[model samples]
Target: MTNKPTILIIYTGGTIGMIKDYSTNALKAFDFSQIVQKIPELQQLNCTIKSISFKEPIDSSNMNTSYYVAIAEMIENNYDTFDGFVVLTGSDTMSYIASALSFMLENLTKPIIFTGSQLPIGDLRTDAKENLITSIEIAAARKNGQPIICEVCLYFEYKLYRGNRTTKISAEHFEAFASMNYPPLAESGVHLNFNEHHLYVPKNYQKKLIVRKKLETNVVILKLFPGITQAVVASILSIKNLKGVVLETYGAGNAPNEQWFLTLLKNAIKKGIKIINVTQCSGGSVILGHYDTSVGLKEIGVIGGLDITTETAIAKLMYLLSENLSDDEFSSYFNKSMRGELTNR
Candidate 1:
C-alpha cells in the first residue's frame, strides 16, 4: 500500500474514452481497467489510481436526470474510500452535467474535478491525455492535510472553472468550455498555478457530505426572439405540469414591454409557475428592473437569474423544486447564491 492520495476516475462515456481500431478505423470505448497501461504518464503522479465505467457507456447527448442521480450515488457509495474523484464525460454537455452535480452534492469537502476532451483518446493530436492527467493531480492536491478544492469543478484546456459557472462555447476547438462570469480556480501550465482565493471552502468542513438525488424535470427554457408572437409564448406557458421556465431575456434582463406578453407571463405566475429571467448573452448579468422592459417582469415576480448560466439555472430549479419549498422560499433561494451557481445581487 502507498501513502499517496488515492484518486478515483469515473468514466461516463465521451470522446475522451474512445479508442480507434487501426485495422477498421472504427472508434470503440477503451478498457478503463487498463487505463494505467493505456496512459502510462498517470503513474508519474505518485498516486494510487483506480477507475470504473458505466455498465453500458453512453454519449453525452443522452445525459438525463437518472444518469445524474446514478453518478451521485456512485460517488456517495465511494466517498470514504477515495481521497478525491475525477469524472469523465462528453464535452458537449459537460457544463450541464457538471452544473447539476454541483447542486446534487451538498456540503462537499473534497475535490470532484470534471474533465473531457474534444477529440478521441486514440487520435494522434488528442487532448485527452493532458486533461485526464491534470484532473487527477488537481483531485489529489492537498494543502496542510486538507483537500485544496472542496467543490465540483470543470478542468479543460488548462483552465479549471467552477462547474456551474461554465458554458460550452466551441464545438471544434480544444478550448471548448469557458467560465465567462467567474475566473479560473486553477490553471495548468509550466507549473500548476492555483487561484487560491477563488477556491471554494465549505462552510462546515466537519459536516458530512449530503447527496441530493431528487431533481425535478418540469422545467423548460423560453428563449425570446424579435419575431416572437403571443401564440408561441402562450403555447409554452401551457406545457402541462410545467413547474418552471428559464426566460432567456435580452441584455440586462430586458423583455418586450408588450401587454400580451406581460399578461401571459402573469397568468403563468398566477398558476404556480416559477419564471426566472436569464440573459441570452454568453457573458454578463441579468439585472432585473434595470430598465423599463424588465421592471414589468420584476413586478410580476420573475426572479432575476443574476449572472447565472442557463445550464445552472435549470439545474438549480430542478434541485429547489424537489425540496418542496414554498413560492416565497423558492424565490428567496434562487435570487441568492447556492453552490456558487450564481452571483448575489
Candidate 2:
C-alpha cells in the first residue's frame, strides 16, 4: 500500500464549517482540528489531514483582498510541509475569491481547491459532508509523485471547475456554481473521471509559487439597460477614486449610441478610467465591432472583455491595478488572457 498523502484544510468561515447544537438550537463553529472525530469516514481515505480555522470567521459579503492575502500567506508559510490545500468559504463569494487566488498565485504546482455547502454542516439535510470529503480527496490526488490539480479550482455538486471561470448561479441549490463559458475539469460519480484534455498543463512544475498581495478594489460594474439615463451614467463615472469600470453592455457588447452616453464614456477614458466592455448575455462573448453600437465603444477606447464573466473581470482589474501599470499597459494587459479568464478573439 502507498503511504497516505498529507492534506491541509483551511476553514475560512462559511456554512460548511458550522454545526447546529441540539440543546441550544443554534449554529456554532465546529472545530476542524478534531476532524477525524467529527467525521470518522475521513479515516477511510488514504490520506492524513490537518486543518486551520480563522479566529473569527468573516462573512463572505465582507471578504476582501486582505483575506485572500492571508490565505496565500498561510500556503506560503507551509509550502514545503503540505501536499495540498482545501479551502472552505461561503458560496456567495466563492467564485470571486477563487478567481482572485488564481491570479494572485503565479506558477502554482499544487492543488488549491475551494468548496462550500448551501446548508450548515449541522443540518440534517446538509450537503457539507460530501463536498468536504470529495474536495479533500481531489486535493490528495497525485500522479507520478506530483499533484494532479495544479491550478485553483472549485468543487460543487460533483463537478470541478477552473476557479477564474466560475460564477455562482444559485443560493439555495446544492449545485451553486456554474462555469457558463468553460467545461468542467473533472466530475465525480460511481467513478471519478477527469477531462485531461481540458485541464491546464503547467510548463514548469518546479517553479516556485509567487503570491501577489496588493490588489486595487477601486473597480465597479455598470450594467446597461433600456432607458439608462445620462445622469446615472455621469454619477457612476464620477464616483471619487474610481479606477476601472466593467461595462455590461447589451448582446454582443452593444450600447446605446446616444451622444450623451458616448461623451461620458469618452470623458472617463480621458480621465484615465479603464473601461472593459463585456456582454450582458450569460454565454456569448463580447465582440467590440459586432455592431454599429459597439463600434462606438471600441472607438472610445473601451477594451473588449471577450467572454469573461463579471466576477473575473472585477478580480483581473483589481490584480492589474495593484501592479501600478500605466494606463496603456493596463489596457494592453486587460485585453490579454493572463489566467485563462477570457477568451482570445
Tens digits of lDDT, candidate 1, 165-251: 999999999999999999999989999999999889877888999999999899999999998999999999999999999999999
TM-score, prediction 1 = 0.99
Q: What is candidate 2's lDDT per residue for 109-205, written digit by digit as tens?
A: 8889999999998799999999989999998888788778888999999999999999899988898999989899999999778888877778997
Error of 2 at 128 (Å): 0.5
How does residue 156 of candidate 1 score in lDDT?
97
Worst 10 residues of 1 by lDDT: 1-10
User: lDDT of each model, Cα atoms only?
Assistant: 0.93, 0.90
Using Cα atoms with residue i matched to residue i, what is each candidate's TM-score against the true structure?
A: 0.99, 0.97
lDDT of 1: 0.93
* Candidates' RMSD to native: 1.1, 1.5
